[model samples]
Target: MASPPCSAASNFDCGLEIKTRSVEQTLIPLVSQITTLINHKDRLKKTEKTLRAIQKVGQAVGVAVGRFVAVGEAIALENEELREEMGHACFEARRSGTAIAQLTDVCGVEQSAGVDRCTVFSDKMAMVKAARMLLSSVTKVLVLADRIVIKQITSSRSRVLVTLEQLERVSTFQEFVQIFSQFGNEMVEFAHLTGDRQNDLKDEKKRARMAAARAVLEKCTMMLLTASKTCLRHPDCESARINKDGVFQRMRLALEQVIEIVTDARPGAEPKALPISIYNGIQDFKARVEALRDCVYCVPCESLAVQLEALVEQTEDFTDSAYTSHEQRENVLQLCHATRQDTHNLVATFSQDQQSIKAREVSEAMELAILKTSHSVSELRRELHNVAVGRASELLKIHSDHAILQALKTAGEDGNLEKVADLARTLTEQREQLVETCRLLCHISGTEPLEITCIHAEETFHVIGPQIISAAQTFALHPNSKIARENLDVFCESWESQLGDMAVLLKEINDVFEGRRGDKRAYLSLPRPGKHSANLKTVKATKLDAEELSTIAKLGLELRLVTSDVDSELERWEDQNHDLARQCGSMARVVCSMALFTRGEGVLKTTLDLFHQAELLSEQGLQLCSLLQDFSTQLLDEERVLMVSEMEKLAVSCQQLQACAKTPVQGKSATFQKVDSCIQHTKGIMTVVASLLPLWHKLIRQCQSEHSSQASPQHWPDTQLSPPLKEDTLNGKGSNGFGVKSLEQHMASLTFLESK
Candidate 1:
């Protein structure tokens, strides 16, 4: 091979063959590997996108599963239908979880491939299958959850509607309260379910739906409570007319039920020793008192007012347990005292109507009830204050100990001897202050001090101090080494754990103390023990004075005397007026007959004689009317004026009759008949005057009665008077003298003559 010498064409041909072999052996494979790597990179990107999508789907499924589980737990144990549905939802959620797990395993297996050349096509297929399965399961669970939620919503809505309808139809208080309580319970359940579901739901829309439902329930509860309060405060008086006893009984029952419902509906994880205002305890107490006050005036049945008062007292006693503040309790007690006094005054007023003994009995019962309620409130306030003071002191001691330990830890870590010493002194001072505070609280609350164990805090700080000294020495020996830092970090971590424990203990104490305090202010801020004396003095100052009582008695006596005098005068005037009117009528008739029979000068002389007699009678009537006016002016001035005017009209009519009769007949038959008609009309006027006399007498008597009954003289004239004379009297048969048979007969004679 070494000896081969070739020409230029042969050499070129050999070089070309070698180059072709090299291209076939190396470059083609290298290019093919680069193409494979690019394809694999693209497939990986696609797989990663598919994996992210699957993860999102899986997470959504997980959240759906959690929601379904919560829904299952929230469904009432007694509701078989909802429970079954919840079970189905939970099962679907579990199946979804299994599918998601299988999908995750597939993704892990696909990602386990070593080379980028192995595409994740199998993983993508698995991801799609898993996603489909998860979607199916999640969809089923969501549907079940929706169905359960819808069912619960429908049930709650129906219950609320029924309760509201029943509330509207309720005629009695008891029925209304029962329905209200039922409604409140349903709403509470609905809110609780919604809240639980909201907490579990990850979907914003579903959570929003739950929040909206809860808000609706809360609004409905508030409206119902407001309605109950309104009814209790100002009950319909017209409803009482239908069945008063039943209405009162029902009202009492309803109020009690409403209070119970409000108490139960209050938002607290646990029942408080003292009730919070959120329960509407104060409002309910006020409502109960107002109800008692209102019912006292128009109680439907005998003893109903008494029963209501007793119930109010009992309610006050119950509400007293809810009062933790001394000021509020004292205020309520004062209000109760005021109500009792007001009721007494009301009873006294009612007693003036000849019901003294009954009023006295009712007042005594109310007084007893109020006294008992006030006593209960006082006792409850005292107990609550004592409890609060004791609890606050204990909690403060715990927190102080925790703070002291924390200070000690920080000072020890800094390796500052002066600061450590100062912290030690502070810890000692804190201990002493805590002890003194506890003693003071115990003395104020009238209770024994509770024993507290703080061994852990002491031990933790005791070890930390020595550890800090060791760490400082180690740092001095090895400044650049991590050993000192590591040691200090370990100590710090251990101290942190101790501090965490102390914090937890303090937090527990705080929670307990705050819960005991409820809605009250700090116990130490309550009024001093002697504040009750001032309140008592204020209550006593409201009593009426002896001078006022004497004035009232004197006024009553004067009224009675005036009434007697007026009554006697009215009777005497009625008789005198009747006699005078009858005499005038007789005289007029005689004159009319004389004029009709006689003519010319003889008739004229007879009319003059009649006029003289009429003058005397008219003078007597005028004197009687003047006397009536004088008496009526004292009580009924307006009536007196009307009577006087009528008397003047009668006198005028009499004068006209006299003038007509005095005219000479002189062979004129028409003139004589006209004179007769004038006399008849005059008799009719006299008859009207006579009829009005009794009415005037009645009005005078009424004024006397009114003056006796009322206290103020200004109110006396406001008394209602008898109605005016009827149309028959003014313009009908009475005015025409047809009411009087004698007058009618006389007028008939005149009519006969006119006809002839």
Candidate 2:
């Protein structure tokens, strides 16, 4: 069910507070129709023109309310818990619509008859009573729909938690595999539901919090698979038990956070003191020492010494870790000691010139000390980043070679237990190396989110090692069992998938260390096809520089506005599978990606990718014209002409967009125009789409007679439009718990099932 609009209709207030973009959008036309009918008093001049206007508006409102009530009744039929309340609301709304329609029925007949007929609507209080009934019942129905959405999310979460418990308690490889498959589907459904909820959220902090919890689940799903396998492989191994248990515990905690966020429950765990990383120390120390330039002797020199010592002390987290290399530990210690000495010297300079604080000699000493300290800390931070990111990069390259996995696969088939044992031992050593590396990286990863990712990595490697061992053992026991071999293969593939995921994590850590946030998914999303796909000996980054990004910020914002308008139109359709609706939705999705691209934060890598998508959007726009022409059969002659003309304009804009996307431009000057023109033309297409969308929607509802109220075009459930999909489609490898197809597909399928 759609959430109620955040703000009720202008001039009409409903007490429920519902805030979602989709719901707000869908209600715009409905509210406009009602507002027109109820506000005839705003213009008291009831001349011939005014009477005609009121009659027309009343007819539109009656038609709209009839269709809305039909949908509400269908929803009531499907959701038993909401049946009685929804049915009452629908009945009242239908009655109010009928009264208003009948009162306005003869207001525009022949002059003398129209005068006599006007008495039916002359009772102002009756019209007012009907308006109130319409507004109140509509609000209640919408609020009830919002409740259903919340309930759907709660049920999905419940399903996931139940499957999670079954997974944790499983023992044998056979049992674990069966339970894990169920766990995976439930996770995918949970992901789909929460992802929708995340996108629908008006609160950015809530969205961000939801995103973090979901990321944990995404990463942990793989870890859970490997950890369970490892526990089965070495049931008696203490480290394996510790590793698997840690993964399950973390996953459970992340799950708890998700449910709490959805239910709006207060967090149960008290917030703990955040760990102080070297990066945090460097920033704090620089801020403190920089302040000394303003007030040298204002604070006690002892305080400066203590603060400097504390900054030096934070480095111990890195230097003292077992995973820190000998060379790295030495470099860190030297830098920390040097930073302490330089800070002490700066403090001493201030102390020595207490009386003549402005003396040049003392000033020079302090300045020199400050410069030395800053340089030392900068070098210290640079070294730490290199050790952490460089080690991860090296490990990834080494692990990319899957020799151990191949040998295990062959040995398991050949029934070579001794060979499998040796391979398992080799895998264990590699796991130890990765686990320690995660610890070292986590020490300097800096941000809490990155740190959480690092811990997840460690848990994954720690657990997957034993899982591989266990899978090998199972294969050795059932050498001829195809299912056992396949199980072993799945575990091995998960290890490789984790390694690939680690490579991504390392890059993210590097981007953060360099202070670049998660803004370049587009570069990674776009394919470097043709010549670009080759391993270049040397080439420039495809990403736009800061200046280019700034130049396009206004255009990007406009892109977001227009595409959102297009999405708003699509949201009103009950048959989201309607040709025009699907076409527009697909275009809106690409526009969304392009808007993010303009901000240097999406999956498109270059202007070329943006052009490619613009071309696709234009093609979809032209196809929408064809669809609209076919759908015009339901509209009146003049209405068809108006809608068709508007669509023709959209098609023309689409042609311009298509031409702009295909045009080749070389230099920076030409390239900039090429991209700007493409996006600008697409915006033009959307503006046309916005104008005609409501008319098309009106035509669809016009077909909703009593005989066909439950037909496809008028039938709406809380579910939006989506393609059908099987549950096992979610079993794709390395998907991070989401299906290979879009999450919307699976989310749609759940509603589809309910409707069926």
**Which candidate leads in lDDT?**
2
lDDT values of the candidates? 0.39, 0.66
TM-score of each: 0.20, 0.48
The per-residue C-alpha lDDT of model 1 at residue 110 equals 52
Give the per-residue lDDT digits (tens) of candidate 2, residues 1-756: 122222245433355455554555556676676556555564366577867777787888889898889999999999999999999999998998888787666455545653555422365556666766776777778768777887887888788788888878877655554566566567667766776776666554455456556655654554565556555655775545665676678678777777776767766565443456667777777776766666644556557678767766766756776767899899988887887788778777766655584643447676677677778778888887887777778878887778889999899899898998999889998898888778767767777656766676786788667867776776776677543565566567658756765776687778887778845432122222342333323322256654466446445645655564565456556767766677778878888888777656668988778888998898888888887777666567887888778877888898999988877655554566677787778767776665566566656665444225354443222233223322222222122433222222222122100000
Model 1 reaches what TM-score against the true structure? Answer: 0.20
Per-residue lDDT tens digits for candidate 1, residues 52-141, read 554554555456556545655565254576676556656654664555444443245455667443222444444334333433443443
Off by over 4 Å in 2: 1-152, 163-189, 199-254, 260-268, 271-274, 307-311, 320-325, 352-362, 515-756
Q: What is the lDDT for 184 in model 2? A: 56
Q: How far is 54's C-alpha from truth in model 2 (Å)?
A: 27
